[model samples]
Target chain A: MKIKKVVELLNAKVVSGHDHLEAEVEFCFASDLMSDVLTVETENLLLLTGLANLQTIRTSEMSDISKIIFVRKKNATEEMIRLAAENEMILIECDYSMFKTSGILFSAGLKPVY
Target chain B: MMHFEFHVEGGNFLKAGAASSQLKKILKQLNVDPKTIKRVVVAMYEAEVNIVAHAYKGDIYIDIDTKKIEITLIDEGPGIPDIDLAMKQGFSTASSVVREMGFGAGMGLPNIKNNSDELTITSEVNKGTTVKFATYLNQ
Candidate 1:
């Protein structure tokens, strides 16, 4: 699924990396645990996380994850946004809980990493 | 061989993985295989976080060559008393503050072991700990 579609479906706001909305992501992984997020080894993966911090961006940097959805109305801090922009990461914010965001995206053809 | 050294300040969440990030870029610029680079980054990042979350201060030393990349992390902090216990999944000594940042879920070492081709750990209770790992580029 394209990140653009995800933004549309979840009513998410793009916090960074607006230039890459047309990029397609084939897999999705939802986790608040950075360690668990680091365990994933998939390409074109979209991370659905509620953890809004610089470490989240660092985790994405290490794991090669370029797109993220911050659920439950979690706001990315300025530092997080700056790092995301630097890494060319598309960070999205939504009011939906992690469960609802995952359900909607899963129903919309986003394959789970597991 | 290319050798790089980086310092890590313990308990500073903001600067935890800076070294790993830098190493990832270097690996990419050197034309290392993407898969190999990912493995190196994952393991290195986790180990780097371990130092930040537990140690007083740390140092990262990286050596890369045509065949493989070797990394060593040494830290001065409250070292692991039981290496066996520390390696267990889901067992962690991270403070509440660290947990809130979505880390300290006790998967760091296991993740490192999973991603690296070879791994070793040594520690002294009050002195510190050292982690060394390698990933083969040609594998």
Candidate 2:
């Protein structure tokens, strides 16, 4: 799915990487634990997490995940935004709960990174 | 062969993944396979975070050759009391602050082991800990 579609479906705000909305993400992994995120090995994955910290961005960068959707309306700090921008990672924010966000995306045919 | 070294300050969450990030970029420049790069980065990043969240200070040394990349992380900290116990998933000794950051789920070592081709860990209770792991470049 295109990141733009995710943003539209979840009513998410583009927190960073506005130019990369057309980027395609093949899978989604939702976790608040950074360690679990590290365990995922999917390519072109979209990370859905409530953990709004520098490590989130770092984890995404390390895992080659180009896009992140922050559920629960969590705000990304300036440092987080700066790092995502520097890494050319797309960041999205949504007011919906993690469950709702996942449901919406899954129903839209976004597969989970299992 | 290429060697890179970095220093890590414990509790410096902000700078935790610097070494791994740089290594990822270098691996990309070297045209390492995407799957290999992902494995290497995941394992190394976990090791790096272990230092930031647990140790007092640490150093990361990477030796990359045509076939593989080996990483050694040594840190001064209150080392693990039981390596076996620490290896179990969901077992963590991280401070509440560390846990609050969504880490310390006790999956760091396992994640490293899962991603790396080989992994070795040694620690002395009150002294320090050292983790050495490697990922194949041609895998």
Candidate 3:
């Protein structure tokens, strides 16, 4: 699915990488632990995480994940956003909890990284 | 072939992934495959994070070539008493602050092992730990 569709489906706010709204992502991994994020070995993946920190962006960059949607209203700080922008990663914020966000995205045909 | 070195200060979460980021950029410039680059970056990032989260300070030495990338991280800190226990997932000695950042899940070493082609870890209690990992570029 295109990231723009995800933003609309979740009523998410694009906090960074507005240019990447058209990017396509096939898989989603929801985890607060950066370690779990690293374990996922998929391409074109979107990370749905409740952890809003610099490490989140760093982990995504290392794992080749270009899109991240912060769940449960966990807003990415300015530093985090700056890093995402530097990495050309898209960051989205949603008010839904991680579980709900996962369910919504999964039902919409996004595969899990299991 | 290229060589890079970096010094990492423990507990400095802000600069934790700097080395990994730089390495990824270099790998991309060298035209490494995306999958191989991801594997190398993930393994190196996990090792780097271990140093920042557990050690007092550390040094990272990286050697990159067309065939493979090798990284060695040596840190001075309270080393692991049992390497086996530390390698187990969900076992962590990270502080509460580190846990709050969504780290210290005890998955760092395992993630490194899973991503790297070869991994070695040695430590002495109260002394330090040295982790050596390598990932093949063609795989």
User: What overall lDDT goes with each candidate model?
Assistant: 0.93, 0.90, 0.91
> For model 1, how does the per-residue alpha-carbon lDDT over A19-91 read when each residue is reduced to its tens digit?
9999999999999999999988889899999888899999999999999999999999999899889889989
State the lDDT of candidate 3 residue by residue for B1-139, as single tens digits: 7899999999999998999999999998988888888889989898889898999999999998878899999999999999999999999998987887778889999989998889999999999999999998775
Better of 2 and 3 by lDDT: 3
Residue A93 of model 2 has an lDDT of 90
Model 2 lDDT tens row, A1-114: 788899999988998999998888778899998888888766778889999999899988988888999999899999999999989988899999999999999999999877
Clashes of each: 0, 0, 0
Q: List, residue by residue over A1-112, the lDDT tens digit for candidate 3.
A: 8999999999999999999999888988889988788888888889999999999999999988889999999999999999998989999999999988999999999998
Better of 1 and 2 by TM-score: 1
User: Relative to the unseen true structure, what is the Cα RMSD of model 3?
Assistant: 1.2
Error of 3 at B115 (Å): 1.1
Candidate 2 chain B lDDT trough over 10 residues, lowest sum: B130-139
Write candidate 2's Cα lDDT for B52-125 as tens digits.
99999999999999888999999999999999999999999999888878788999998888998889999998
Say which docking band candidate 3 falls in: high
**lDDT tens digits, residues B24-131, model 1?**
999989998888889999999999989989999999999988888999999999999999998999999999988998888899999999999899999999999999
